[model samples]
Target: MLIKMNNIHKSFGTNSVLKGVNIEIQDGEVHALMGENGAGKSTLMNILTGLHKRNDGTILIDGKETYFKDPKEAEKYGITFIHQELNIWPEMTVLENLFIGKEITSSFGILNTRKMKALAREQFDKLSVNIPLDQEAGRCSVGQQQMIEIAKALMTDAKVIIMDEPTAALTEREIQKLFLVIDSLKKQGVSIVYISHRMEEIFEICDRITVMRDGITVDTKNIPETNFDDVVKKMVGRALTDRFPARNPNPRETVLKVRNLTQKGVFHDVNFSVKSGEIVGVSGLMGAGRTEIMRTLFGMDSIDSGDIFINGEKRTIKNPHEAIKLGIGFITEDRKDEGLILDFSLRQNIALPSLKSFSPKGYMNRKDEQDFVDMLIKRLTIKTQSSETNAKDLSGGNQQKVVIAKWIGISPKVLILDEPTRGVDVGAKREIYQLMNELTDRGVAIIMVSSELPEILGMSDRILVVHEGTISGELPKNEATQEKIMTLATGGQ
Candidate 1:
């Protein structure tokens, strides 16, 4: 084994997140760490990468017991981690970000700019990545930034690499490129710990699979010995009868329409309509303008040209406030930045968007707000100790539910959900799907943008594939397939 972790135990306050988890990864093998959203996958990775201290465990690196004091120490021992969230400095150039701490220096200790650029270029070429070496990392697309992060790990000559949801934002083509890189790494005898919720990806690339549920290790099996259904059953401890709720039989009349929508460099000439009681899915690769289109619709972005029709009447939406007042709600993809107020209690966050409903005169009504939040909490089945619990203290899945509850409390006519189930567990995903169905049944039109093809295929009444800032193709639910959507999303003619 390249690395062996035995009896790993960790806890946070009263929560036991990891309990005696044991896993072994071999060199040159892609080992997948499978689990639900809060099932200790991230906790185990954090422990291995030295981000958190394990209460009790034996971590053996290269057949010897070893402890990592910090991430730097783990890096020095040929281990690197690519976090689920982008960790690059947006203001710095790609090359600078890649070699941020481990800079090349001359004998006199001066910065070796020439050598660094050349080395970065070499790494980019070797990995088949096309990101500009000198371009600011912030300006790059999410997919490009992900590739840069992978290249940074390569630059460190890491023998063991841990990737957490690496393909979450990548396009089909980008994912293929990433697979090629992984193939190369495996050939060179690097141990890979792949953590992803996408079952297809785990089956396609992993040599071995390990499943975790509720902070415990359930089983580890060779990829060929287990299938997707087995893994899913282990992760959630129950067979999923239906991944998506039944589609609406009677979709209401068109409630929102976008005609000739244009956002210059972002998206151009986009046209779509949403009918009440319908879920319209927008599917695309990273940087394909899916989120941008949603942002434009939500008034979070300024449109260069377009006419929005509400209830068969044309109107202008200048900002989010205008959109909200027009009965539109948005659940952002970046929940941390756009969805929740971490410092606020769950009740406060849920009541924020709908404060007007609870306000008495010019003053806020705390009692009314609390009542409204209490209703939402019960409706959404949010797993929290109390309404006073800080939004930041909730798990990834619960935090996401809070975000949905916040928007659902507003009771908008149109709802836009960007990656509604991005980091959520399978069980939570099912709950969200059910919630969407319930909303549609109540005559709410939903526009959903998701990178997961399974979700798009399962939930969408109509699927629109975006490519290069344009709607490449549109398919009805019956005709939409993974292969077909991917073809159009890659600019296939």
Candidate 2:
């Protein structure tokens, strides 16, 4: 075995995130860790990478017991991790970013720039990544940045690598290239721990699979013997009767409309509308400008040209505050960075967006805020001991609830969710879907942008496929399918 984790137990304050989890990986094998959003897969990986201290566990590398005090220590033991969020300096060139910590030094302690660039180019070529070594890392596309992160890990010459949702933002072509790299790594005898929610990738690259649920190991099986449905059933615990709820037969009058929306290079000449109590989904490949449309609609990005209409009345939105004032709410894709204030308590995070609503004569009403937060927590079934808990400490699913609660508190007429369940687990995803249903039933118009095809098809009343910068095609709920969406999204007209 390349790595063995025995009876691991970890907790944060009163919340036990992991409970006696055991897993083992062999050399030259791609071991996939499957779970719903807050199922402790990340926690286990964090422990292995020395990002978090385990309460109790014995980790063995190559038959010897090991304990990592920090990520550097883990790297010394031939272990490296590539997180979902690429950690690279935008200002630095690829070469500089790759050799950040281990810079080559000359005789007098000066940096050896030439040698580092040469080494970086060699590593990039070896991994089949075509990114320019001298270019700034941040200037590269999201897919290229992801590849740079992997190349940096390779520079460490680690024996075992852990990748967390590495393909989340990648295009189909980029994913294929990544698979080729993984294949090469396997042939080189590198043990890979692949963590992803995309079931297709698991069956494509993984040799063995381990499912985690609420911090415990659920099951482990060979990929050839198991299938996506079986794996999802194991991860979610219950067989999903229907992936998406039935769409309402009648959508009410148009509640929101965007005419000739243009944000310059971001997105151009975008047009759409949402009826009251209707769920409209925007589907496209990453960087196809789906997110830009959402941002522009929510007033986060400046629209060079376009007009927004609420209840058939044209209105100008100067910023997010104005958008909110006009009864529009937006939930960002990156919850950690844009959605929540990590240091704030759950109650504070929920109330931050709508603070004015709970204020009388410019004085904040603590009791009213507490009562509202309490109600939302209970209604959302948020798994937290107290609202006093820091937002950063909560799991991904709970953090998402907090974001939802913030917007739902305002009682907006139109809600826009950008990848709302990006990292959430199966159970949490079901809850979110149910929440959407409840919201729409109450006459709230929902505009969602999602990368998951099933989510776009299942929950949407209408689907708009965007390619390049414009809508390639639009389909009603019954006519929408994976093939149709892909066809339109890939410029199939």
Compare the candidates by lDDT and give the number of the best one. Answer: 1
Task: Assess every candidate by TM-score.
Answer: 0.93, 0.90
Candidate 1 to truth, TM:
0.93
Q: 214-254, model 2: which lDDT tens digit per residue?
A: 79999888899998678878888878776556666357999
Clashing pairs in 2: 36-425, 37-424, 37-425
Worst 10 residues of 1 by lDDT: 241-250
RMSD of 1: 2.2
Deviation from native of the Cα of residue 467 in model 1, angstroms: 2.5
Q: Write the per-residue lDDT of candidate 1 for residues 53-157, one digit (tens) a residue.
A: 999989997889888889999999888999877687989999889999999999999999999989888888876677778899988866678788988888888
lDDT of each: 0.87, 0.85
Global Cα lDDT for candidate 1: 0.87
